[model samples]
Target: MTARFHTLGLGAFGLGALALSACASQGGEAPRMAQADEGEIVLMIGLDGLRADFIDLYDAPNLQALAARGVRAEAMIPVMPSVTFVNFYSLATGLYPESHGLVTNAPYDREFDTVFENGVSTQEERWWGGEPIWITAERQGVRSGVMFWVGSETQIDGQHASDWSVYEHEKPYDERVETVLSWFDRPASEQPRFAAVYFDRVDTVAHREGPEHPLVAEAVADVDARVGALVAGLEARGLLERTNIIVVSDHGMTEIDPDNAIALDTIIDFDTVFVPEMEGRGGAGHRPFAMVYGEPDAIDAAYAALDGAHEHMRVWRRGETPEDYHFNHETRGPDLFVLADTGWSLTAPSLWSRGYPPYPGVHGYDNHHPDMAATFVAAGPMFENGVTVPAFENVNVHAVIACGLGIEPAETEADPATVERLTGGRCPAP
Candidate 1:
């Protein structure tokens, strides 16, 4: 079946066109997978917007089998904003969004005087910072391949993944799987030790059909089928036993009531304040949180307009954001943050004028909310079988993958305890 995809900047197939162009400009050739001294392979699969509990909610026998045979986390806590690009980079770098500098999927950088929007803008490497695990592995002479993982397109720190696909939604899932298998077929000296594959249909279905809709269950099953195929292929190649397969998602989805959306214009007089780099309304990416930019006085008014407008939403200055979020870093943070309560979203007045239909589901709520938790399951030589580990932050995943692939983990914010829990006390660093 052909997967229908939305055009959201964060998880949409619309960016695939731009990604194709970028790849063509970069010579349109796959990078040579450099072999690592250790033959151990690590495959990191990201199922975007996978709810933490959905694995059990749906008939995903493959995922169930994975959990039964390998270490599975009770929950995977995502970073603040609980958005796509934010947590994807966080997971890749083992750092919070504030540290990595890709705070939002569509962050506006004041220094560069640009916005890192969902599509073409992400192609700019300047928008990315912090060393991703693939870059770390590449630096250590290990080949890494990324199948459309966030931030894989750009030339970060003057390097790209050894092998990667330009984003293209038209590419069938089976084709993606075949491409991954082909990577392993390379000579040992050119085999990638660390590889990542991403799937967006589950998240897409969640956004259009709500997380609780029956369609989501079907989507989960489809993804599970893909996972099963991947495992089967690895086993066929005699690589399953040696490969560390870590399946994860950046964040989860929540149902959004169409009538519960708060319009920004009704709350704040746009004439009084300038809100730039704002998404939602009719925009592709809509969620529970929005980034508002304006002068200091204007920011105060924007905050006041929505402070009591909705019981489910809250507004704050970027610095005033909760410390637990770790979002108060020095780059492109919004002057004002407006966060909708769970299952709520902030929209534009124009949307109301146009009779805009609310998204069936959305995310970007407080990371601490259970609704925002993602998925984490690992099965491979590096993991202890049948172990259910306690929840850990997504930032610690990079270190775990690095350890599995025998690459030295870069200095990161991952707590020692978090690593120990995931690695069964076999963490490489103290």
Candidate 2:
């Protein structure tokens, strides 16, 4: 079937025209294979904070091989703010941050009038509201598995992935890969129809050391080797061809010079901004850019003050955020959100005292920045071969995966064109 593009409320440049050309060039039929079945296993490997340019810089033989074998997108544009929790939820729910409600790494719940930070354990109720892919799969009687997704610990719609693990930010990369292989070894009866694995070392290392740093390059090469190993293992067991493999990332990284640190004292009142309990020790959210939680009136005044005083920063109100943001109201976000200028970063006072200089790479910039574009690649029986499509919004991932699984998408905000591309234009409405 020929893929049709439907333009949503978001402005359209040439995306629709490009999509149409993509379909027409393929003779109105998405690639197909003999193993195309409903219950085939789907594997998604998330390499956190992997930028599109990394592909050009690094020697990723395995990733390059995957692209050579199957479909690859030039880049994948993450949702607004482009933070971890926000984009991860966007991938799982196929909804923008606004619809999924996870606006930042640390969000404030306006409903309960409370704030949550990185350290807070996300309960089933607090972390997730909309149904994720795993939950929807389980409801359809198809088992699913997750290792360290944003809200894997949470139970959605009274259902969760059959096998799951808690979110641990500091876990070793090798251990995470091993766990996923072990899950694949389980008996077919208990095996998951869908599985997701996350790796943080690349992003973590990049944040501390610049993306060009040898440590960061070493981490990226390590992830690429791990990908090769995982694919080889599946091939050895005759599962590689049967299982669809999707590799993606939350967002990309950019260099930050220490000389560019924006002093918090220069922008807003340090005394009025209440430091919540869940913030990290020396993280960006803790020092120069505190997630302010307080009365709405006070928050509004603070936003206005910062807007006028700081030329490099911008403050967004709870509900007045741009429609493209997809943040789920202020429920899990701060009363006010602040973003620093391109080269500027937030730092704690103690870090300077201890002689610890800030790192040179970061990723929490606005989504429009080209450096923030993440990577997306897919290889399996169901995907078209050697195809490189133009960049699209990251929220469309949820719907694309759902289509591959022959399941209904849990969220409706995904672009229809993505659904058509993934399902061979066979998706039904949510």
Candidate 3:
């Protein structure tokens, strides 16, 4: 396997220098598709913000049953900048955020000199770089479908799923399942071999009510019920035997005290460094984490200005970042990353002026943090029954699904053993 990460000046830069070269390769020999007898349809469902322990915390009989029947990982670790878009794209492409280019939910891309926001940015295809599994499936002569996934709505590598829809959140969960069921109703030749569905209610509610809030439990139940409905619908159509149900989450949420906000003004002087004001948009990155893109020459001064500025926030220079997080994107990312301590947040002065309260729950913390671990479970024909795997990165999810579909995975940072364990050595050629 080719080395995907290139670390430069590790010892010379110490813990503060940025150590990234460029995005990883976008090509590799596609995996050999599985034979008809070995091929298994995969349906990956992303339950946003569902923690690894939420299944046990809430009364989710359907999820518990799914875990009992098939394999459930103790936890699924999210990639760095443990936010929605980064990890979701990671799960889709089997690449880290550095490789996929959806580094954060909102990020400033210097290449295009554009700030990628939620709605306006998603439509731009250049923002998405990696080859998602949908495209990989198409390459191997297999059909794929997606309902409201990160990259599914836009074309990646000049192609997207054979069947897909623009993301619609207001639609009820059951209606979405019915839409998926409609796809299954197609003749065997036209049915999708691999599909994906995304559910955000749990994450939405959790962010408002906190993960431990009663509303979060209710949201978990609602999603579990939705999962049950999907399974039941498949069973009614006699598709359960052939389809593998892979349930996962983008990233877990953590409760934050509204009063524990760290104002950026208190940390660094805006006059000394380049304040991250992009086209009148002043806020840096999302809360719980903030990225500061400053004058290249003033980086040391900027680093010194914010270093130990707040006890709750840690400042990382370009090369000083942890190699494990893979967030050293000097070109695409900020020069300095100010990560709020878990359970805390970094806010802008404008928020206080406008009286915007801190969010009850948030993510985007270091992926290794305990509170950021997401869930993973697999059941049906392809996965081993009643087996449990150790914690693995969400990037491996695409590989697991690719293995089930019997197609070569695109270039990924996931471990090969994860795909092996998830498929129980049933996966075909790599």
RMSD in Å for all candidates = 9.6, 8.5, 9.9
Best by lDDT: 1
Q: Count clashing residue pairs per candidate.
A: 1, 12, 8
Kindly report which residue pairs in candidate 1 clash with one another.
Answer: 33-190
Q: What is the TM-score of each candidate against the true structure?
A: 0.88, 0.83, 0.88
lDDT of 2 by residue, 1-430 (tens): 1112332222221112111011111223332232333245678889998887786788888988998877787889998777788788778877666556676666656676565545454763665657788887777666788998887777776667998987777787778777887775655556676899888878989988888888887888888988898888667555687677888999988887777665555555655665342233443332224456667677776787766556666677666555555553535555666666666665435323244556677777777678788999888866777778788888777766665565555644677766456544445332
Model 1, runs deviating above 4 Å: 1-38, 276-286, 351-355
- Ranked by lDDT, the better of candidates 1 and 3 is 1
RMSD of 3: 9.9
- The true-versus-predicted C-alpha distance at residue 273 of model 3, in Å, is 5.0
Task: Output the TM-score of candidate 1.
Answer: 0.88
lDDT of 1 at 182: 83
Q: Estimate the overall C-alpha local distance difference test score of candidate 1.
A: 0.76
Q: Assess each prediction's global lDDT (C-alpha) against the native.
A: 0.76, 0.68, 0.76
